[model samples]
Target chain A: MTGSPRPARLMDGTALARRLTDETTAAATALHRRTGTTPCLATVLVGEDPASVTYVRMKRNRCAQAGIRSRHLALPAATSTARLVDAIGELSADPDVHGILLQHPVGPHLDERAAFEAIAPAKDVDGVTTHSFAAMGFGLPGFVSCTPGGIMRLLDEYRVELSGKHAVVVGRSAILGKPAGLLLLGRDATVTYCHSRTRDLPSLLREADVLVAAVGKPDFIRGEHLKPGAVVIDAGYNPGNTGDVHFASARERAGLITPVPGGVGPMTIAVLLAQTVRAATRQLGLD
Target chain B: MTGSPRPARLMDGTALARRLTDETTAAATALHRRTGTTPCLATVLVGEDPASVTYVRMKRNRCAQAGIRSRHLALPAATSTARLVDAIGELSADPDVHGILLQHPVGPHLDERAAFEAIAPAKDVDGVTTHSFAAMGFGLPGFVSCTPGGIMRLLDEYRVELSGKHAVVVGRSAILGKPAGLLLLGRDATVTYCHSRTRDLPSLLREADVLVAAVGKPDFIRGEHLKPGAVVIDAGYNPGNTGDVHFASARERAGLITPVPGGVGPMTIAVLLAQTVRAATRQLGLD
Candidate 1:
């Protein structure tokens, strides 16, 4: 198994996400045609961190392409927690807004959870709120955190059988790794969560049938940790557009693997737009 | 390994919980003496299911023994979700109530999550709401679900090293298996959740270093599934007071085990009382 020179099947998340976005665009157009209500997504950012700004701009562009209107509310870097919550509350109550997205890393001073709690669960398409987390945990119908949500969609698109498979998630951030593990558990996969504190990462990672590398360190998961023929979803995008997994070595060992830039990234924005349209349809009682 | 006849060490939950209750009593008494305010637990039971009635009664008794006050609200089984939510809202606002425990299974017709959401997160000692779940997941400072909280305390008391250990939880109920897995994950343990839908239960169970048997079925976990020297925490109490694990067989091969009647049951009530006093101290601005 170690000397085999077979290349892994690349899981084409970009292509699948393109199809999904097309479906979302048709649904958004149809909803507007029938109800005369355009689905709207409100994007809130506390500071103009360049990366966060780029990410928010990309999400807005995706919404526009999907026929969903975007509202941008850029606040000052020194915005108080209460004021941020108030802004989110206003957008939550706005009848025109179908979904809410609060860009992450809100200056490190703002209370992200408090601001997220202010968004009504119905409009939490970014799925940062506790309500959405619980709904995801309990396998209830609610929006999901986009990266984790998109990874699951990619797995489904490739016909991965999750049941009874040992899925080792290599990070435990509230939105990404934690929720991803819960979603896999909902699909009957036996899920294990590892993080910086976990002892002997290689020992556990070697047992995973499905490995999700979401740790934000470049090439953190080497080829030796991967089980042969594992389905690897690399959700990490560090500086220089590098991924957490060592793709050159892993692509040979893995049965199916997602590339760094063209993999989980494209699927994430696609899920956000798709969920926004669903939120609008559900809120408008058109579902 | 299979032929070894070593008897498992019994985790004495009854004694550990007694010590914990004593500590809670001291705190409750001290808080009352300093602030002239008694810690109060508001227990709302929507229906008179005999088991729920007995469970609530046991919890109230434990609270009284720990110098905490218990306020019971018995509602008709047919109570509307709105009315139940209103009831919980009143208790949440009541200054005298430091902790709230809405008895589970508040009738299938009622929106249980809605009613639980009505209880303020500060007062949710039972830890049923999504806020508490997220807190548990994120390892934020918040009250935990009592039974899972108790199980963690037991593991700590026995000097269990959770980091990197495979902790397999055998149920997925919102409060028990799910939160238990989250708590283990927070401790850096590799957690796997298996339910009725899991295709290969014994295979996964065989790898667990810490096995939490929460499946409601009696003797669901046999001796063959347990790893040698594994710490077994059986949270299940089926009819006839039998636990999910076949204790007679499991005790021979396991390193530590909890009995059916005396184990998880005692620690749960102890945690509720402890949290109520903590809530009272915090609410009274005496923390």
Candidate 2:
């Protein structure tokens, strides 16, 4: 297979996610016994987008398995921004709800940020609010964006050394790429952000010791562009069940890589559940 | 002179600052005439570190010159974080106070972030709060750190094209380097942050089309490290009237450069005055 040099080891995100789910289950049980209040996550969805609906359902089912309760709010797609804000505000004020997750892409007309900001900082389990973002940037105590947080966990589990390494993040979306890069920077890896406006992508990619493919385009990063033995993280998901990086050729050059299907997807929900328990424990004064 | 290339065009921050000050003065006068209330800035300083005191005085003097009122609060070095927080909270609540500037390097014992959070985001004209930082990162409406804001203004006056250009930030201190890099990123520049842990400094610097030298150490960057014809912004302030970049050598290679003393220094105060008037106008519903 094209002079494969041991075909770079795949990071096992699915296995790690299972381990995390078990741990979260125990923590949720302990929290429930101590406080007599099941950790509740308020999940809000403003539209009937199939992807968002399925994703929210997946999270709620996981919550049930972990002994966490779900308070689901399904608003009409035509809801006003003000009404959506009010709905989230009610969830924020409810003491029983330990965490909040507002499914994103709440329609183009709605003010997503205004709605996200309505989630109380303490209950922002999805880490979508400005408060959580600032806390992440400042290295303060707060919940992190689930996907980026999971990517970091995967790197840690694989024992990849981040310090002094050149990490090139190939996207700058608020939740995924920007936070991922900042989190890497916090670990002392020299960080660079290359976007659509980047002049020379191949040149920049070759300098990266760790490359995070976060641009939502299938096969955006190829083996030719990769630095030898680079640690590649594919954080992008497309409709055809592929990642931003071309898997087959990338494995030839990469020392460590994440597969499209099992790499970043499961870890995200696992992190969300774990953070939900932590949020509940903190709110219940048991942390 | 070893092949003296035409010296880099010096960015005249002093002249730009003067023009900005004239604009700020006129704005302040208009706000006062319409609302019958002068724009007021509250300057809070902890510990009488001679340099801190001098810097506060400089800002206060500039505020007065711009037709802005100053309320100075100099806390004793021994004051606890609680006391500092309480003092800042009072000013945040004061209706007459249009803006707040808390000098950085507030003693080692106190929680600086906690104290910063006490100031309401509305009056955070100095932009040290988490809200302001998030706003800056999200490319939303908010105040910005004075020095970084001034650096942006200087770049604008010179008609520097930032889109798709590589911007290298030499440091990552909370107030200066971090904000400056984020600001550049918002302007669509491909940004890189290189700090003490960076492995190859010269390699990264050579890629920069817009280089921001913000490391506090003098002579940290040299001419050989710069990309020939790069826009060099030396935002460092050293004790002996020098900046982080080696001026004589850098001028030979740089296409445009800011001098240590007259560049980046005056423009900071100008932005502060301008933001104060803006805060007042917005608060008074005149915006």
Candidate 3:
């Protein structure tokens, strides 16, 4: 049996991210010239999660390409919470480190929130700090979570009007789902957050003008769940690089759909690099 | 023509808040006996906004009744942001000031976020600071905004089951609306936030097992907006002492409804006093 054709125009993160990185490189170079120090991002990885390792490496590589410095701290899988906190504390106090990124799923035993809180809000360039999240939610001036920031940038790029739209964000994770809903709310889109426990997810989906899938479940949201011509952002990256939404079916009904592998993933690193430069400039008073 | 008979069950805040205050008073007395210094809250108000003045007075009076100490700071209406920041910074740095409450709507010209950020997270017992907001959103240990905190307490008092329910919050303001939504989300509720710009808000409201009205509009949510057997919390207090939800109509539709003046307002002061004592105990190392 032949499958249905793709109906939505794909929101390409690769091209947009490349453009952003180019701009970030120029900013980084300018800051370095003025402050005599390159913008630096310290990445902390606690355990040996292969996926996390790949993500960190990708971030560092992107940093290098953007003329920013990268510092890696790899702790053992059995690292104690105190030791991890101490290491993060040191980075927080270090003036040389402009930004800090701690890859998630640190370890089964570690106090992840404590470690994240240890990072100074100013150096929380990855926007993982609680202060940043609150700031985003309150519509205050602060850094944003990378994926959510990327999603906002994409919306701006597409000129999708958010002011009066009904945005339904699937998932409520701190880094992705919760922050996404808050950001949309800040932009004047009335937002609804659906998670694993939500009843009748399909019914909620049908009422959304913009639907953001960040639940990490492959092909979880189907075509029948979507409202016609709704803007779809599939931020889920599962095994084999599939998205949370059934792309083929959702695309048929969506006005815009972002692909799994090349959509939100690329923009994460791009935002990190951009934020690192911003941090450096702010700290060095170069702006 | 006779008006429709009152159909809502009034969720009396005045009576519930009095009980809560009594409990807080007992807790405060116990703490005071254990520790010499009484639980103290520093109330900072910039300019004399009548509403803010009334609220501050109410908070202080409640503190006195609860055996909590109150320190008042009344700044001029034309206070500069930097000066205001310095004043807050001092309060935050003071060990004796266990909690700080900076009343909002501090003159239109002054930057409220900057001033709010000056309060140390440890002393931000009112949960207006960015740090507190993030902690609340992340489900971390932190004090919550008084009104939202009170709402949660009321729910617990009434034994409302929150897990796996759909909660629709009508408003997105910084302190009340947004924080209320986050608190519900943390409790495993699928939460949706509807505001003035929201399209088909009635549809969203009908899906809610729990409805929170905080839009500061009188009777914005009517009986038609409620789902049968829904738990309704009206946080709005307009000039005529009207709540956001039309309590009369809502009572017939909702399983529960908070009254206009007597419902959520009293709890706000109750939580503030409770948090002040808790903060004092923590600061005194007597907990």
Report, for every candidate in turn, its global Cα lDDT versus the true structure.
0.91, 0.92, 0.88
Best-first order by TM-score: 2, 3, 1
Ordered list by DockQ, greatest first:
2, 3, 1
For model 2, how does the per-residue alpha-carbon lDDT over A141-221 read when each residue is reduced to its tens digit?
999999999999999999999999999999988888888888898999999999999999899998999999999999999
Off by over 4 Å in 1: A2-6, A34-36, A80-83, A222-224, A283-287, B2-6, B80-83
lDDT of 1 by residue, B1-287 (tens): 78236789999999999999999999999998988888999999998999999999999988888899999999999999999999999999999899999998889999998998899999989888888898898888998998999999999999999987889999988899999999998888878788887766787798889999998999989777889889999999899999999998898889999988889988888888888888898899987
Report the first chain's TM-score for all candidates.
0.98, 0.98, 0.97
Clashes, model 2: 0
lDDT of 3 by residue, B49-89 (tens): 89999989988988999999999999999999999999999
Interface RMSD of 3: 1.0
RMSD from true fold, candidate 2: 1.5
Question: What lDDT does candidate 2 reach at residue A128?
Answer: 84
Evaluate every candidate with DockQ and list the scores. 0.58, 0.88, 0.80
Off by over 4 Å in 2: A1-4, B1-4
- Model 1: per-residue Cα lDDT over A1-287, one tens digit each: 67236878999989999999999999999999999998999999888899999999999998999999999999999999999999999999999999999998776788888898899999999889888899899888899999999999999999999987889998989889999999999998878787887767798788889999999999998777788888999999999989999999998889999998899999999999999999999999988
lDDT of 3 at B58: 85
